[model samples]
Target: MTSRPGGRSARVREAVLDAVYAELIHRGYLGMTVENVADRAGVHKTTVYRRWGTVDVLIADALDHTRETDWPVPDTGTIEGDLTAIATEIADTFTDPERRQVPAAIVAAALQSTRALQAKQAFYTARHTEAAKVVTRAVERGELPPQTDPLELVRLTCAPLYYRIFVSGEPVDRTTAERAVQSALAAARTGLL
Candidate 1:
């Protein structure tokens, strides 16, 4: 099926991203090629090259697009509640089989390529920045201590989830996520974080 030129840009991007994601899952990072993604997307190789310029950029963009959209950070006026919300979101993404594999490939690519590392850093920076705002709000509400480090808190809250997703290869559920959040909150309350 042919997509309209200007009217289907967003749709075309989504199709390309989906194709790239599938290729990443099946072929792994090292095996993924722009030609393969282009063929899978039913778009020309030149179109893919013209749009993304490089395979790393294309893959990074696909990974970023798959992440939860406009997910609001929780601000329930309690640090525990906010952490719980954050943990829930993390668990939801990690437990999804397709979604889980994308990050694994991205991390593998990042370790081997400077461009991938930079792209991953930029993506995480934006995500953590948003998360920091939530922590900042909690601090303002007196839920967390005045000197609480927002970035550290964000890391602490997500460390276990990432560990489980990447290392343990275990399913991340609401229960597991809640535990991570609870652990972070406990540590924070005791000045550990």
Candidate 2:
């Protein structure tokens, strides 16, 4: 039989994952150590090693946990409002110095580790799938055409903000979020998506 959700095994996993996130934010990927994470989690180093085996796996497991957590999908009664809310949230996350380190570290780790790379891809896929609900809702409400691809529209809505944060080194604000939403809406209306 499977273990209960709140059993000792689950608690250990939760503590270790939380420690991994804290360690990653504090020391980044290169400086993060399994011993340090185990210490922070109040577990022995060998326990961490026996389970995760490496720093990359710890980070991957943390990401997997995050992906499984429920994200609040926006429902503002309009496609524009929902899309804007989604884009704004992305801007808010990357704009925060402490929160920004997690994704930055993930990208850095994915470059060197295949496990991290797959985890990163799966994380984004889950997020995009969840956010695509807004587009799907818009179609049901007759705001967007039936042919519009919900996932593609969701990706278009997020792409520009990510481009600014990860590519162009540009400042992202409420106005940037609005622009991204409008651009994606325009694309959807024109059947480009």
Top TM-score prediction, candidate number: 2
lDDT of 1: 0.81
Q: Over the stretch 3-53, how does candidate 2's per-residue lDDT look in tens digits?
A: 768788898999999999898778877789999999999998999999999
What is the C-alpha lDDT profile of model 1 across 29-56, one tens digit per residue?
A: 7778999999999999999999987778
- For candidate 1, the per-residue lDDT at 12 reads 74
Count the clashes in each prediction: 0, 0
Backbone clash tally for model 1?
Answer: 0
| Clashing residue pairs, backbone N/CA/C < 3 A, model 2 | none
TM-score, predicted candidate 2 vs. hidden true structure = 0.91
CA lDDT of each prediction against the hidden true structure: 0.81, 0.91
